[model samples]
Target: MAKAKVTDEQIIQVGSELQKADKNVTGHALCKVLGGRPDRLIEVWEKHLLESNSDENSLQYIQLSAGLEELFQSMSNDILKSIKSVLATCEQNILTQADKHVENEKVACAERVSALREQLNDANDIINQNQDQIDSLLKENQIINNKYQKTIELEKSVVELSTKLEGYTTAIKDKERIITEQAARIESINAA
Candidate 1:
């Protein structure tokens, strides 16, 4: 028995029913309704949808197929071969453009990485140098503190010595006063 040709409206109805299905209406489910294998129907449906929405570059096959009927009816073998070669060249050009874009992105990434590494190295070197300077300043401050402590001790000693010298001078003056009093008393007794 010959198979009946399915209509576009039927296909659309099956797709719509699948979309609104309460249960997971898988591609397999839609295929079963179409009386075709699930995988095959799903592939056809997806291809149809893609072709309808695809950009000019991605729709190359669909565009070519539209002209294929005319080309086959009127064109010679050489002309068909030339058209295929031109399509192949277009595909190659797209691939080359994609490769150049990837290469440019990679170079930019490498350059940015190298620059960041250099900046990090510079920052580390600056930190090291500043740490060294800080250490030197600390050492100098410690030395100055030691000298100030020694000077304070020396001043204390000088103050103590001055106090002792004042006591000795007071003692010498009292002894001289006693000696002068005894000499005056002897002279008075002799005159009497």
Candidate 2:
């Protein structure tokens, strides 16, 4: 027959002996711990510790006369309040730093906007200067074009005046020929 598994009571008795002998209680994590169900085995060691410490454990001996109990409660409350105050201070410091950071960002943004406006003004000034130069160049070009048109008209008038002079010269030569012929005829008649 398979030997029956060792009981939790038996294991507890061994653990107690080991404790009394000042030896390590369970050499390992209860993997080979004798006998009990696995779940019970785990709690068995804890039960041994409680059983051994029963008399010495303060929480088990609970005869608090109201006064000491109130003092302990007051002490815990004060500690909690102090902890909350420290947390609040830390939170306030974080908020202050965040506000300062936001202000710095706003100032930096304003400076950037001012710089961009200055650049825009500079660009506008350059554009106006270029436009003024363009207008002056256009006026000069108009003056040159007008002078060229007037020169062309003057050349046309000179050509028409030369044509009229040619016609007058031809008529004068014909009149001079007629007068010379009449003079010759009159001289011949007188001679006759």
**Residue-wise lDDT of candidate 1 within 52-73, one digit each (tens)?**
6776556545545557767765
- Model 2 deviation from native, Cα RMSD in Å: 10.6
Q: Per-residue lDDT tens digits of candidate 2, residues 1-192?
A: 765376667777777676787877653534354644556565777887787688578676787779998998899899999999999999999999999999999999999999999999999999999999999999999999999999999999888888878878888888878888888888998899
Model 1 stretches astray by more than 4 angstroms: 1-91, 179-192
Q: Write down the worst ten-residue block by lDDT for model 2.
A: 27-36
What's model 2's overall lDDT? 0.81
Best by lDDT: 2
Alpha-carbon RMSD of each model: 11.1, 10.6
The segments of candidate 2 whose C-alpha lies over 4 angstroms from its true place after superposition are 1-72, 169-192
Question: Against the true structure, what is each candidate's TM-score?
Answer: 0.47, 0.51
